[model samples]
Target: MTGLSPDARAWLEQHGFIPTDDAVWLEALTHGSFNGSGPADAADYQRLEFLGDRVLGLSVAAWLFRAGDAPEGKLSQRLNALVSGTTCARIARSIGLPEHIRLGKQARDDGGADSDKILGDVMEALIGACFIEHGFDTAQGLIYRLWAKELEGDVGKAKHPKSALQEWAAGNRRAPPVYTVTDRSGPDHAARFTVEVSVRNVGNAEATASSKGEAERLAAKAFLERFG
Candidate 1:
């Protein structure tokens, strides 16, 4: 499309995405709110996101199985961390995908392009588009390339921060950390939550995210960083 930058086009090409039908790829970058009410039609990213989620799961699982000799539990943990929305958004940002996303006037003005939820979904949809245009092997190669850093990171560190924090609390003889939703704001479609995690006498930290669960996880991570 005309709006896509030369670099973006090149990046897509590098990822093996050369769309014969531009409409599908364009739809992959389009938000449901692009029409300002809901999806203007069926040509939005949700269905693509659904497909991409599975594709990502399979690709990551297969890669991990071959890449490591870890047992199933460790592999599952690593896979969950790798496929999380936070990780997806990180990958999307690394590739400048946010700039390619199409949003409605209101959504754009509301910072939809910067929303982790939108970026993560768009990343998945983009992968789906790659799969559709190319095929599984090509899409898997793209996933591996995009996700290389995460896949190669210390697997033990891939343990969930909340789990680590809870273990820290138990070992330190402190009350289990408590998380409270301190704030919820923004449009319903793009709501943000601020959560606080506190362990008595040790420390407390707060973080904001697109979902309550993510907010809680981030808050726990922050608390551990600050105090543990």
Candidate 2:
């Protein structure tokens, strides 16, 4: 089997993490779709991803709380943005994680390696592995390092546009924003989805992206830009 590439090893070393158990790291990079059998191997990243979600939530919340007096609501918003799958996928790409993911032949051919969902899941799994191997403090440090830029940005606007639009609707006494998938095309691996969001009596916006969530976010941002 192919092992971690030399560059991948160097990247981890640069981040101050050296795996004590290589098997765990490998499992963290494995996807469920990798095995077409009845059930995925117990070592797949799903469980690790689950743990990592909670770990990430706690880590971000604690940091936001300690960093300043940003009140609960603002802190929560920043936390959501920081731990979002989009942000996770961005971090994964920044660190060259797509090259390390293990996938089935079909999945690889289908662009699974660059999929936001897969990258986000694998990123969380890697964090879980880090937590298990190096303890929470180390995992927290890694998270902080990876998220420093985002954390330093405008925390007020860190909320997803979709959520921001929803709040605007509520404050303005309007119906909630409704989103519908207006178009979809492309192959399974690189499919694109177009979503349109309409806010009652406000306006409509449309966007397309490789994933539905991203499309929705873009659509919301567009609507907000045009009418908000």
Estimated TM-score for each candidate: 0.86, 0.85
* lDDT (tens digit, per residue) of candidate 1 on 173-214: 999999999999999658899999999888789999898989
Which digits, one per residue and each the tens of the lDDT, describe model 2 over residues 121-184?
8999989989989899999898888888877777445677988999989999999999999999
How does model 2 fare in lDDT? 0.83
Backbone clashes, each candidate? 0, 0
lDDT of 1 at 96: 80
Which is the leading candidate under TM-score?
A: 1
Query: What TM value does model 2 have?
Result: 0.85
Per-candidate Cα lDDT values, in order, are: 0.85, 0.83
Best by lDDT: 1
Candidate 2: segments with Cα more than 4 A from true spot? 1-8, 36-42, 155-159, 167-174, 184-192, 200-202
